[model samples]
Target: MRTIHAPRLLLLLGTSLLVRGGQTLRSGDHERGDVPGWVMITLMSATLVAVILFMAEEALTTMFKAAMDKVNNP
Candidate 1:
């Protein structure tokens, strides 16, 4: 003859019941909210472009000045 602990048995039963209830209430229906993913993507792209241009500004200006000096002295 085997005996089960009352508290443990009750806890297991309660957990199983909760899990089953949750599964029954679950649904696949979802709403497409007003949040625009494209806007975030566009903003991120613009930020990257601005950072690249800012980082290269000095080098670009130096090259432009060199080109102008060569043109003027030639």
Candidate 2:
């Protein structure tokens, strides 16, 4: 059985919220020109990075553990 990691889940949820918030900001009244395009782009880039890091966490952890074990046992 696969276990769900809470921190990873929170990261995903936060990324989703960031994306949704960015969309809402983009869809707001344009006449006021309150939302800048760069802001949305930055939010989306951050979300992407968060997701990538979340996905890579397990692999990175495994690699680190293996390296540590090699050093300790050698």
Candidate 3:
């Protein structure tokens, strides 16, 4: 599963990066000599937080299923 999952996750992240990168680059004002570094940091931070939450939820769900299976068999 790790072999299949890792590649899929990478592909998804790569696609997201390409799309978001274009949007972030285009949304900037051309007159601005430097884009705000803080904004990019914040966006990346938020994305990481969201991904963490999603993974946590998935872990909890797998644990729940395992617990239920053990109970049913015992």
lDDT of 3 by residue, 33-54 (tens): 4444644665577567667756
How many pairs of residues collide in each model? Answer: 0, 0, 0
**Model 2 lDDT per residue over 1-74, tens place:** 99756557656766776686678777765564544465567666766776787889899899999999999999
Q: Which residue runs does candidate 2 get wrong by more than 4 Å?
A: 1-35
Off by over 4 Å in 3: 1-4, 30-74
lDDT tens readout by residue for model 1, 1-74:
98655445555655665565455446433353322353445445655666776689799999999999999999
Model 1 accuracy (lDDT, Cα): 0.60
lDDT of each: 0.60, 0.71, 0.66
TM-score for candidate 3, please give it: 0.34
Error of 1 at 3 (Å): 84
- lDDT winner between candidates 1 and 3: 3
Among these predictions, the greatest lDDT belongs to 2
User: Relative to the unseen true structure, what is the C-alpha lDDT of residue 20 in candidate 3, on a scale of 0 to 100?
Assistant: 64
Measured on C-alpha atoms, candidate 3 has an lDDT of: 0.66
Best of the two (2, 3) by lDDT: 2
